[model samples]
Target chain A: MNMRCTKARRYLSQAMDEQLPPAVTRQLDEHLDACRECRDFREDLALGRRLLGATEPSLSGNFDWRLQLKLNQALQKAAGETAYPWLEEKPRGRGWAGNFTTAAAFGLAAVLALAMFIGPQGRVMPDDAGRYAGFETSRQVAGGVSDRLPLNRGALAPLSAPRGIQRSVSGSFGLGDFSPNAAFVLDSGWSGNHLKDLATIQELKLRNQRLNNQLYQYQQQISILRRQLDRPDSNGLDLGR
Target chain B: MNPSRDEHRHGSPSAARFDLVETRDEDLIVMVQDGNRKAFDELAARYKNRLFSFILRMVKEPVLAEELTQETLIRVYIHAGKYREIAKFSTWVFTIATNLVRNKMRQRSRRPQLLSLNPAPADDEIPLDPADPVADPSEEIQRRELALVINEATAAIPEKYRIPFLLREVEQLSYEEIQQVTGLKLGTVRSRINRARNRFRQLIKPLLKDETLLAELEMIEARVAEQKDNPS
Candidate 1:
């Protein structure tokens, strides 16, 4: 066989696959007809294809059943992870800490509101009769004394004085007296509405603190569940097996 | 005639209103990407036999082939969203199976002892042409023996050539499709398949001395020549 025979042999294989151009097929056919060696090679190639084609294998009967089980397990796991990506990683400790911080903030706000209520009450000054008398005499000496003063009686009233004295003094001064044990109070010269507004604000602060605590506990539970889901054994789907 | 058959044959008004639904593999795969489990099952059922045969021939072990086939299908199911329609679905699937075979071959090469056993039972099914009557039991036995010899000869071929050969002859993949699956250039795929055929011919030459086999070869050559002449 010459070099042309070798080339023709390659063309023969391509011809079987329907890959050869018409020109090459004609050249190969001409070579095969003239060369006995190339004809034998062509025969061998055809025989090999026939034998290989006949040997295609088939799977056993139970193949699909077994594969289906494994596939279902894998798909289910994939779906679960897709639905909750947090299950793939550890729930960050920062998330739970953030919730705790928010709760702490609410508590701080409540404390600040309580302080606003109690801080001014501790500094309450007793209504001294001598002080009032001195103040009246000074006013008279300085200038002609007015019939009334513009002081806030509710916040500055002397609790130590009798009710009658307190009433008489406040009435003469044209100021409204309020209870010393009032839950919320503003500075003197403010209206009664101001005190009511402060009390409403303190009530809202307490409610906000309660809601924040509830939210913090719920977040903590979610973090715990996320951590559990991240564990390999938690879902009872042993991936390694 | 049955009422549905009469309706179908006569092209009834209701039948004309609905188009026939013939889902292609790409459409089924798109459905899979959309999280349709039934579509996934359909895809798996469609490719299981072809994939198992290809992987089995590559690995030469039934159990490993079955495992690899399942792994390939599972990978497809999980990564359905990654598939692009630029390539044929078969090309993509065969590429995955081929990569897995390469990995298994590499692992086997590392541990020679592990490769010593091939416990899977040999495929004993005969490929008797249904059109031909079995006139003699001896002839059937001869065909089976010839098939076994051919299987051994194929297994003896170099892995580089054997893969392209199987992809072409067994799987009936086009040269371009084989190129995509193997990541080889067009010229390389052509040459590898040619060399594989040459090698297979040399290996099986001794077995072809039988008169019956030679006659079969002649018939095959004549048929091939006819096909060439007709160019169909």
Candidate 2:
């Protein structure tokens, strides 16, 4: 082998790695002596190796402190967030107990509500059927009364104004006079023996009015209940009053 | 010489020691797994400075390097059980470090577009205070200038070559050990190092004047001699 060629090949990897053999070392020395280009190449290689060696960047300052601080934080986080082995190993019976208590309380509340609304006195009577029929008639009357009175008033509104006065007025005159409370106030607190007979008549009339109001409320609730029940998946919803 | 049982047997001691040290890494991991705070502290004391330097070099930004280093340790703790003894512990640790830096670079590339919505930070605004204060001003300036040149040149090298270059040149990993770390063929590792050195020479030629290069080498030799003499 040509010594120059051997030297040139050897010079490619010789800065200060002690692992290089003596023959290769001798070749590198000889090449550096002869060739300026090879010599310059070796120098550049040596410089890069040196600079990179120094560039580890001491990390003694806050940068390193901050890093250790972070490592501690990470260790802490790992310790904290680790899944409890017992959770997977042991059954979670507490959840089942909580669910049981919630379900029992709900069932108890529903039974109590059922007792209040639909038990004994709350039971349906023949009079209730009659009252329901009377309620239907009253609804029809109210709806017709509203339709005849004005275009804007609700269908279930009561009539209080004189039919003649309602016909003449227009432009957002309120149906406030049509409220059951307003009408009930007029019927309540008036008296005399001729007026007691008149008062008895008025009391009977007010009783019918109250019964109508109660019936109307019950009907509205029943309709809402019916609509809810008609739904395929009501999910046992309770529409509390 | 063709390799034989005797040579392999001789090699086994260091390999056994490697296994022993690896068990230490595992023990540290197990302590972390067991939630031993003291063990974590000991582990941190042992590996913190070295890992920080490794990550800092790989990522090239102090804050990001610190972040990756922290993340790697945390990962080691969290994934202690997953750490099989298939490779040396240091190799595995560096592998984790290398992956994090690569991921960070990828994330940065993705972020530039997203960050267009936000005002960009000024180049000088990102602080990079070198932890060591150089005793000589000339050496300091030269070191900084050299770092800049090397950083640019290193980008041109292929990643395969770059990893080994960083591992061997920057990290000082030995040839056989780097082979063990990287799982590269020995011949492949040797050739790549040779090529890496060649590429580095080509890259630095523009920045380093002839006399300046010689002076740097002389300083390295002097430093090496001093370190040997002191042996602290």
Q: Write the per-residue lDDT of candidate 1 for residues A150-221, one digit (tens) a residue.
A: 234433343334443322221111112532433322222212245754664565455445445555567657
Residue A117 miss distance in model 2 (angstroms)? 32
Least accurate 10 contiguous residues by lDDT in model 2 chain A: A165-174
> A183-226, model 2: which lDDT tens digit per residue?
44332221112454466556656555555556656765764564
Off by over 4 Å in 2: A1-11, A14-40, A72-241, B1-54, B84-86, B109-142, B210-232
Which sections of candidate 1 miss by over 4 Å?
A1-3, A80-241, B1-21, B115-147, B212-232
Error of 1 at A173 (Å): 55
Q: Please report how far candidate 1 places residue A45 from its true position, in Å.
A: 0.9
Chain B, per-candidate TM-score: 0.70, 0.65
| Best prediction by lDDT | 1
What clash pairs does model 1 have? none
Q: Residues B1-232, candidate 2, lDDT per residue (tens digit)?
A: 2222232223333332322233365555544454444445666666666777666655566656666777777676666667676766677677777777778878877876454586666664344565444246777666566565667677677667777777888777777767876778977877788788777777776657667765765675576567669766
Q: Which ten residues in a row have the lowest lDDT in candidate 1 chain A?
A: A167-176
